[model samples]
Target: MIIQAVAHRGYPKKYAENTLSSFLKAVELGFSHLELDVHLSKDGIPVVIHDHTLDRMTNGTGRVVDYTASELQSFRVKQDEHIPTLEEVLRALKGKIQLNIELKQMGDYYPELEKRVLEVIEAFDMLDQVVITSFDFDALERIRQLSRDVRIGLITFGGSKAILDWSLEMGATFLSMHYAFVTEHYIQRCQDLGIQLMAWTINESSVMKQFQEYPSVWICTDELEGFMDVLEMSGSI
Candidate 1:
């Protein structure tokens, strides 16, 4: 089986998560897919970062939405890397890799965030190369309303049939779930339903070996090298 390893947050083990440098490194390391998060800045621009707040990942100390894209860039991630606008990431990785852009929303959704994100993807002409994902069902519905051609994925922590049904209802082609919840039965169900499954943030060698039996499932992980090693060990590379 071929292992499809998606660089989660662009090789977070080596570089600061979600930074352009990390993304470039992932690309350079021959990863074909990368996953990143998107949140709207105060000025309505989509910026690349995982959290609603910048306190953990950067030198800043407040909500990311409180600052404009320019202001947010002033804060350094790991004291050197600046927060990247979504456009910057798209421009840099346009042809190099496929992107899984998660519409990150906690508590309240961003104003017109789905529309704005679509606009950016359209501007880059990357609708075919990117899949917009979200844990928010409403946000995914909003995305469907705006564009029919762009692909959508539902990010869920639970491995329930209801979640799968809801994904089908919304015409989502992909379902991203936490790796721990994924089972052989679950993989078969996804395959039967014609929906692709992405196992998120998987780093363990045992889990990596287990997933190798199912070539249809994509593995999203921070340890790109570790996944590669597993592939090599199995002579599947």
Candidate 2:
């Protein structure tokens, strides 16, 4: 399979990251996959927000779950964008791109997260369009334990052979990793094991160059134009 360009939080510097407009812009640029964050709202609904606290990303005054989905919907996100529901995002990106929805349930919030996320995805009839990821291996485990259908990805701050083994046991189809932890040997290991390797938040040309030099490495970047230009010049896109 060919590597794809994924928008990081939806062209963040220019548009509101994780909002509907931001995601649409990425799709317009021909990016077929997007990396986004999912957090539980006060009513146990899954909303697409990047942080646990809403201070930085929205006009809200507290934690994400502190506000109901309707309460959050009215709040102005960065650049005055509405806090988009996961349903809106799925509808907008429907047939446009694959979504890598990173689950960030901390403390005791993981209880309904698996059900809410899977329910939304299932309602949209988008089992193939969605991939769930988390730094919390237990979250991935629970999501996997819920069903055999959903595709799961392991995102990590670091990695090792043991971690990879654990990922396999959890039934993950891909590993989203930091660029520092990825290497030729690791890539080979992934390929040998029939798993895809995707690295995130790569916004610089230097990292793209490194990924380009390696075969079958999927790099998710925010600089879509710059990344495409580099890839075109190097014949790597």
Candidate 3:
């Protein structure tokens, strides 16, 4: 079969990344899952965004945590998009797509970050439709403790046997990684263990071909919708 595409930060190439409009566009394009980054706003609300600092994605320039949700709204994302609250994004896409929320931890904000994400997910009653991802095992474990039904992914920038072993022990539902880490052997190994593999930030046609050969290779990318169009045209994916 084909790999399931998880649009990274909701197809950043098409719409402003991580905004409600962006997420809706991916859902409308038939993406069953959309990936997003979560960070606590200045007032402890969970907001959908990818950067610790707002300089890249928004009009304002400062740490995300430095601005309260109200302050964050004043700075628009590119193309005049308001930074939608996580609650708004979730509700907009509710019942339409599974959400993969990557917790971009900054220093010791693990406990607080985990708590805020849980609060919003619970508010939407979407604990079942979400998969929490993080490189911080402590934060992942802490979230694991907080919710039994919510699936979790252990985020890794690089691949290794040791990390694999730990991911198994941690009962991670998915192994999310940088695109370079995906391979035939890696796919086979995960199959043996009944684990799903997901790669992040992929954007090349050749790289997408390498992934298509392995169906277990789920993926997240900003250019995913465009890539899907190419695959359909070529009849390769």
Candidate 4:
């Protein structure tokens, strides 16, 4: 089977995370799987970003929830790139790549985040090309009730029977976890449930080589170009 390579935060080393340019560069580099995070703006628009606070990635300060979508756009990332909305990212990469959108949970924020995100996905006609994932299992369960066909993944930090059970109960198609948690038994358990495994942040060539022997369907990483080169050299792609 052909393992998928997901660009974590869309080639962040070269471009700003969650920006249109970053996603475009991932596509240009031949990455079909793109992983991103989503948070609702104060105005109820779903914006693509990873952090709850804007201080680290953007020119703005304070919580990202404080700004409207338009206001958030004013903040520059790495000088030129501005924060992008989920719709902008969906529009830019809809046909070119598969998206794994992580729904960020902020207390009393984006009460309808799952619904809004599904609306955007439906609007872009990308329901088949996206997998909604989160550490919030409740959100995933709610999403399942809204749309039975939407693909969802359970994001976890460890490999355990409890995690597997939860994922299976939620009808998750993928189990996304930290790379260190992936083991032979973990792979088998996921496989038994017909769930594809996705290992995250595997940047080391040695670790990548080790994971290549496993049955993970996708490997998410920051070093997309480097990992791709390694895979090609090893004839694993």
Candidate 5:
């Protein structure tokens, strides 16, 4: 069995999450897929970073939407790593790896976020190489409205019939769930329903061993190298 592993936020265990260097390093380590978060800057450019606020991941403060993309890039994530624009990330990793771009919003959503993100993806001619994911169903719906060909994934904390129905209704190509919520039965259910399932942020070897049994399922992890080693030891890769 081959475990399909996605480098979650570009190997956050070793580098700053959502930074360009982090993504490039994941590519250097030979990960087939990379997951990242995107929020529209004040100027409406899609920039990569997890939080709607910058306090957690960068030296800056306040809402990400408050700063222009260029202004946001001025803030340092770690020692010197600047926040990257979606275009910059796509330009660098376009042909090298598949990207799982999460459209992020909390409270009030950013205006034209979905449209701007699609424009960026289209600008790079990477619609086939990328999947847009979000916990915000409305945003995913907006993506669906904009382009039928673009792949969409519904991200949720757990699995349930309601979630499945929602994914099906949205015509989502993938269902991304928290690892703790995934089970063999759920895996089989997704397989039976023709929905591709992905488990996220998995780091434990024991968990990796368990998920390896279902080769059709994808796993996203912060510790990509460690998880890969686990799969290698179990002869699942």
Candidate 6:
């Protein structure tokens, strides 16, 4: 069994995270799985970004929901990088690889985001290859309501079985969680329940080595090439 690698925000070390350049870099590096974050704009467009506010990643300062998609185009992630619409991302990476689209909606509910994201994915014919994930259990529920065929994942941080229980209740087939929560016992339980496990933000080689035993688990990482090197040295890749 070989552990799979899921590029977190498409190789953030080489390009700005959640941008087209980053995703393209991930594809060039031969990564089959990609993870990204999405937030709905004021005009109901799902934009690819990690934060609720634009200040951290882009020149803009307001909450992402306050600005329309077109308005966000003016704010630059850098001189060359601008905020990308979810449609643009879907078109760019459409047939190249599988995607994990993390919904960024937390407290302020955006009722149309789930519908809009599904619409974009449907247009691109990527429904089967995509997994919709979020820390908000309600958001995952909404996604389940919209389409049972679409894969839904629960993103969590702690090592509690309650998270798995809630994820099961939401009909989630995947659990995306912090690496610290994963254990042999937990992995076995998830396998028993038929839930696939994915560990997030794993960058260290030592930690990567630790998860090699779980061949089916997907390890999400920022250092895509480095993780591959670890696997290569271990003769696992």
Instruction: Note the Cα lDDT for every prediction shown.
Output: 0.91, 0.83, 0.81, 0.86, 0.89, 0.87
- Winning candidate number (TM-score): 1
Angstrom error of the Cα, residue 83, model 6: value is 1.0
- Candidate 2 lDDT by residue in tens digits, 25-94: 8888888788999988889888998888889987778888888999989888864698888988898888
Each model's backbone clash number: 0, 0, 0, 0, 0, 0
TM-score winner between candidates 3 and 4: 4
Which regions in candidate 6 have their CA more than 4 angstroms from the true location?
A: 1-3
- Candidate 4 residues lying further than 4 Å off, grouped into runs, are 1-3, 106-108
lDDT of model 2, residue 17: 89
TM-score of 4: 0.95
Q: What is candidate 1's TM-score against the reference?
A: 0.96
lDDT of 5 at 90: 94
Q: What pairs collide in candidate 3?
A: none
The local lDDT score (0 to 100) that residue 104 gets in candidate 6 is 84
Q: Which numbered prediction scores highest in lDDT against the true structure?
A: 1
Question: Would you estimate the TM-scores of all the predictions?
Answer: 0.96, 0.95, 0.92, 0.95, 0.95, 0.95
lDDT of 4 at 147: 94
What is the Å distance of residue 93 in model 2 from its true position? 1.1
lDDT of 3 by residue, 133-232 (tens): 8888888888888877778888887777887788777778688888886667877887888777888878887787677777677867788656786678
Residues forming the 10-long window of minimal summed lDDT in candidate 1: 1-10
Note the residue pairs that clash in candidate 6: none
- The global Cα lDDT (0 to 1) of model 1 is 0.91
- 60 Cα displacement, candidate 3 (Å): 1.0
